[model samples]
Target: MKAMVYRGPYKIRVEEKPEPIIEHPNDAIVKVTLAAICGSDLHLYHGMMPDTRVGMTFGHEFIGVVERVGPSVQNLQPGDRVMVPFNVYCGSCYFCARGLYANCHNVNPNATAVGGIYGYSYTCGGYDGGQAEYVRVPFADVGPARIPDWMSDEDAVLLTDAMSTGYFGAQLGDIVEGDTVVVFGAGPVGLYAARSAWLMGAGRVIVVDHLEYRLEKARTWAFAETRNFAEYDDIVVELKRSTGHLGADVAIDAVGAEADGNFLQHVTAAKLKLQGGSPIALNWAIDGVRKGGTISVMGAYGPIFSAVKFGDAMNKGLTLRMNQCPVKRQWPRLFEHIRNGYLSPSEIVTHRFPLEHIAEGYHTFSAKLDGCIKTLIVP
Candidate 1:
């Protein structure tokens, strides 16, 4: 079998590897039909994440047909088309019972992490990922959601992770009817945040990003108002001005890094108070929120850590939540949404390349060429 293997940072290669077989009583073997690269994969590419081991496959978002199932796996059987949630969790755990599958006791025995990410790193469990010809889906009965008869494989692929993350961010942001929400970054996740916010009945959704292609793409096709981060002299002021001086009801930091601004002034904002330009995205989110509103974040982090202005956050009575996303909890809801035809996540896919041209697909996607947001690898 052929698989895309991670040799090291910035060194992913397509190589021949043995096919996967069931190793657990609850495991199932899936013949991958569709798999998409995720932003989280970038962490592995950049060597920013510590858990990514060499020679491992590195993708989590995919939909496939069951080639075989473990004897204990009864809910899903041969020929069943399904999407694998990014996490590999047992449904009976304490966290799973409370709908916090990310922190599942059965999945994350290390207790250092909350959720299991496919091909991410050993930190999350060194599970093989879906960026291959076949994948061994552990705990399939609990983690796999059935793809609908009406949806295509490409459309159902994102229900595994990216869409679920966006939905989680929106749910945390408290998107309600008539509320205005601002989302930072127009990447795949951010665009989905805008979409999810709209589905939750938000009155207005604003997507912010510096990339002209992404900004235009979000506005034109995704149905969200957009702002170019590069054009805004001050995003917070711009958003407030746009929202009639009251700011937005909820602001989401879909961009993990801080943008340029008055960060030095409030250097001591927390204990350091760094103020003026504290990562414009978070600042914009903090400032954009209306009084007593929420600020949600879905961007991956830890490469660079900054001092947060807890006092400022507290002053506005803001609520903050950030994570790798509790995909297990959102899988069923996202599946229902897809079945009902409310959100089509596959629209973000701009380029497709055969498995033989995997290298080329990586180049185009990494460069963000010609409105490319998400790229899929076909085997």
Candidate 2:
């Protein structure tokens, strides 16, 4: 099997690796048909995440055909076409029973925080991801769902992470009808969050980013007002001015570790590895939202302290809600939305790479070249 192996920071290559086999009674070996390079994967590519060992494959958003299933995997068979959520969990755990599968206590040894995530790092449970021809899925019955007959492979793959997380961001916001929501970042998650805000009854949506291309996508695809943070002297002030000086009703941080607005924060977090992740987006979110509003954080961050505006959030009485999205929890509504033509997840896809050229795919995406919004790898 050929898989993308991480050698070091900014280094990855497609190489022959041993095929995965069922290791647990609830496991299934999936032959990956479609996989996506998520924006969060760049954290590993750039050495932002801790304990991302060399030779580990990095990918979480994927869909596949089950080639073999363990005896305990009763819900699926060898020939089932399935979409596996990024989370790896046991369904009967205390957290899982409460629909908090992303925090399942029975999966990751380091269950103090996030549960097992496919191909994230040792901190999130060192599970191999599906950035290859084959991947072993643990707790297969709980995580892998059969792809709906009406769904396309591209859409199914994106739903595994990006779309689901975006919707979860909006869900966390608890947007009231006619509320103004501002989303920071215009990546796939940001775009989806902006779009989902509308579905949640937000009267207006604003997407903030530095890239013109992504901001354009925010305007067209998400139907949200766009702002280039680079163009503003102070983005929070600009957001406040745009929202009639009170601030937005809700703000979401969709850009995590690599946020670029504050040069010092970016350097401290991304370049120097000082804090967990740059809190520029989150701080902007806190400052951009009105008093007593909500702030939803869907961005991926490391398990370390970040210099955030906790004092200001407390002063303003903001409701801060966030989690590594319970991907399967959002599937039912997402399936309905896709079925009704409300969303075409694949429309965000801008590049496709063969398994052999995954390095090129990573480079293109990491560099944000060729107008790449989303890149898919066909294995």
Candidate 3:
């Protein structure tokens, strides 16, 4: 089997690896048909995520065909097409029973904050991911759903993580009718968040980013107002100005560890490893949303202290909601949205790379080169 193995920060290579096998009674071995390099994968790629051991693969979004299944896996069998959610969890856990699959208690002995995630750092559970030719799926019946015959393979892959997470971000905002929403970062998640806001009855949506290409994507693909943070001396002030001085009713932080607005913060968190992650974008969300409004955090941050402005949030009485998305929970609504022609997840795919050229794929996405919005890995 060929897999993308991490060498170190900014380094990865395709190498031969042993094929996976059914490890648990409920496990299934999936032959990956399509996989994606999510922005969160960049945290591991750049060494922002901790416990990301060398030789560990890094991918959490994928769809595949069930090559084989354990005796207990009755929901699926050989040749069944499936889209696996990023979370690995037992469906009967306390949290899972409450619809919090991302916080399942039965997986990931490393931490209690997040459940098992494929190919993410060991901090999320040292599970090998689906970035290779085949992957072992644990608790397979609880996480994977059969890909609908009408859904394209591309859409199925995105629904596993990127699209689901984005929609979850908007759902956390609790947007009301005619409310204004501001989304920071124009990455795939941010673009989807902006688009999902409309479905939640937001009257206006604004997307912020430093790159021209991504901001352009915000305008065209997301159908939202765009602002290049690089153009404004104070983007928070600009956001307030654009929202008629009251600030946006809700704000979503989609740019996580490597946000690039404050020079010192970026250096301290991203370059120096002093903070959990750069709080530039999250701080912007705190400052840009109206007082007493809601702030939804979709960005991935390490489990460490960050110099966040907690006092202001307390004084403003803002509702702060955040968590790793329960990816499977969002699929039913997303399926309907896709079938109704409200979204075409594959349109954001800007590049594709074969399994052998995944190293180049990572470089392209990490550097934001070639107007790349999303990159897919074909095994």
Which candidate number would show the highest lDDT if scored against the true structure?
2
lDDT of each model, Cα atoms only? 0.78, 0.92, 0.91
Off by over 4 Å in 3: 261-274
Candidate 1 displacement at residue 241 in angstroms? 2.4
Task: Predict model 3's lDDT versus the native.
Answer: 0.91
Query: For candidate 3, lDDT tens digit of each residue in 1-379?
Result: 9999999889899999999887789999999999999999998898878788999987899999999999999899999999999999999989999999999999989646888999998889998888899999999888999999999999999999999999999999999999999999899999999999999999999999988999998999999999998898999999999988989999999998868645665566567766656787888999999999999998998854657888988888899999999999999999999999999999999999998999999999999999999999999
Displacement of the residue 121 alpha carbon in candidate 3, Å: 0.8
What tens digits encode model 2's per-residue C-alpha lDDT throughout 323-350? 9999999999999999999989999999
| Cα lDDT of model 1 by residue, 1-379, tens digit | 7888888756788889899988988899999898888876765665656556788988888778999999899899999988888887888877789877777777755646556767777777888888888998988889887887787887778878888898898888877799989989888888888889988999988898888989888887668998886787777788889999988889888765323335443243222322212355776688787778889977765433455666788998998887768786786777788788887888888888776667666667666676679888887
Q: Model 3 compared with the native: what TM-score?
A: 0.98
For each candidate in turn, the TM-score is: 0.89, 0.98, 0.98
Q: List ranges where model 1 is wrong by over 4 Å.
A: 257-280
TM-score of 2: 0.98
